[model samples]
Target: MIAGRVRGVLRPLSVVSIAIVLVLLIYGLLGYSVTAVVDGVLAGSVTSPSAAEQTLRWTVPLLLMGLGIAVAFKAGYFNVGAQGQMYVGAMASLVVGLWGDGRAPVLVIPLAFVAAVLAGAVWSLAAGLLRLLLGADEVVTSLMLNFVAVLLLQWSTSGPLKSRAGTGQAATSESIDAGYRISTSTGVSVPIFVICAAAVAVTAILVNWTRTGLEISLVGRNPVMARWQGINSTGVGLVVFGFSGGCAGLAGAVEAFGPAGSLRAGFSPQVGFMAVVVALVGGLGALGVLLAALFFGALRAASLYLPVVTNLPQSGIDLLSGVIALLITATGIPLLRRRRRRRRAPTAGGTSEVADRPVARRREVVAR
Candidate 1:
């Protein structure tokens, strides 16, 4: 019994473990020195004080968005629009921060953060409601919205909010005053860390210790059964999606206020997508998501350092990420399909055997 339980627990863990080993193996075969790569990753991510800060900087947004993905996955929803949601949130924060015009930091900061969260939630709800009401696919809607959000950010930064006296290839909004900023350019700050800790704690409790969490899990496993149990599965679905988007928005606000300090075009472009990978690697558990965020954070930090040290292009890191996402997605598909086939095949075979046995028995009776 103990062995069986242990196997059950370890089964999910094997997926992430395999992915890590595979990534390492591929890196090794590419003529990249394993020690140097490992050491580089370590040296870049945490061996030095600056490296640790960089890791933390990357960790903040990844962790926030990963948590959002985890929640949606737990509810059996694929919210691929975190990137769009984050963009919208950042844009909203920018408008509020710039327009607030030097209000007390205590007041302006909280209000801007709240606006960001609400904007993100509302943006996500559009897709969620469409899925619930019109049967429009969430995946398609969310993915398309990402482009729309990106375009909107470009418009905002270049047209209206463009920083005066700023001249660069990329347009960006005026920087928030120092008092309104959450952290300096280095990204780590007491406020950012405190907010992240709170988010993690709250989400962990919601997933592990709340009735809503139980209902969300039940709906994910079987909506029909959940409905039979008198649960409002549709409502649960919307709430989960909204909450997930809101978290992504909160991460965007943090990026604007804490590290980036303004709305920049293409800011955090792929962090939302990376959060999806982090969610998958973390096995959709809050604690797992935390650890996975750290690992991916290390990778992000290392990616920046690689171009400086090695001859590898920054695009190489993107290629590696794309490969991992493809492999992981492919791996899950087979397992899911096999399980479905196993379930359906047994019923199909049983029915066919029952029909055949009756015919054979009749033939035996007629012959006798």
Candidate 2:
């Protein structure tokens, strides 16, 4: 019995393990030196002091956004509006920071953060509301919102928030006050790390410990069953959407305060989408999300360093990431089909046994 159970557990894991290895082998055969690429990624991510800092800088936003994506996935919502939500959050924070007029850092910074979070929540809630009320498809709405948010950022930085003495191809708002800035250009700071840690901790607790978390999970797994069980699935959907948006917004605020330090058009353009990849690779669990974020963060940090150290272009890294995402998604199909077949096979055998046994029992009773 123990051996049977062990085999059952190992079967799924072995399949996944083999799939990952196959992906690596394919990449290796594509004229990419796996060893060299791995070494370069590690060197760029954490071998040196500056490299480690860059890794942390990249990890923070990815982690935050991954957590957000996990929340939406848990609640059965596909909120692809994270990119747009992040842009709105950054824009909101920039407006607050610029207009605060030298207010106390304690006062202004917190306010800006709150504004960022609220902006993200409102932006996401629009999609959720549409999904609930108008029965609109969220994927389309969220994807379109991303472009709208990008344009909004361009407008804000180029028009009202344009730097007074700027001369460059890229438009940017004025630099934030030094005192208000969270970190230097290097992007690692004590305060920002603390905020990210707190966000992750609180989110994890909410998902694991709270009643709402249980309800949301139920809703995701089966909305009809959740409603039958007396859970308010609609409320759960709204909460998840708001929470996801808030997390993305917080990431945007961190970028504005720590690394970017000003509103810039197209800043962190596809990072939000990349966070979805991180969440999926991490297995959509909090701990998985954290680890996956670190891995992707390392990739982002390494991408910058690769050009300096190797002959490869940044496009190579992009292509590699895209390949990983595609493979992971494609592998899900066979795994799911196998699981479904396994489940049905047992049910079919049990039904046949029940049919044959009842007839045999009746014959034995009549013969006796």
User: How does residue 323 of candidate 2 score in lDDT?
Assistant: 66
Q: Candidate 2's C-alpha lDDT?
A: 0.78
Number of the predicted model whose lDDT against the real structure is largest: 1
Give all candidates' CA lDDT scores.
0.79, 0.78
> Residue 343, candidate 1: how far off, in angstroms?
17
Global CA lDDT computed for model 1: 0.79
Per-residue alpha-carbon lDDT of model 2 for 237-301, expressed as tens digits? 78998999998998999989888889889988879988877766665568778877887788899
Give me the displacement of residue 248 in model 1, in angstroms. Answer: 0.7
- In the range 211-310, model 1's lDDT, one tens digit per residue, is 9999987767665556668887668878888888899899989999988888888987889889988887676778778887887787788888877766
Model 2, residue 62: C-alpha shift (Å) = 0.6
Candidate 2: worst-modelled 10 consecutive residues by lDDT:
340-349
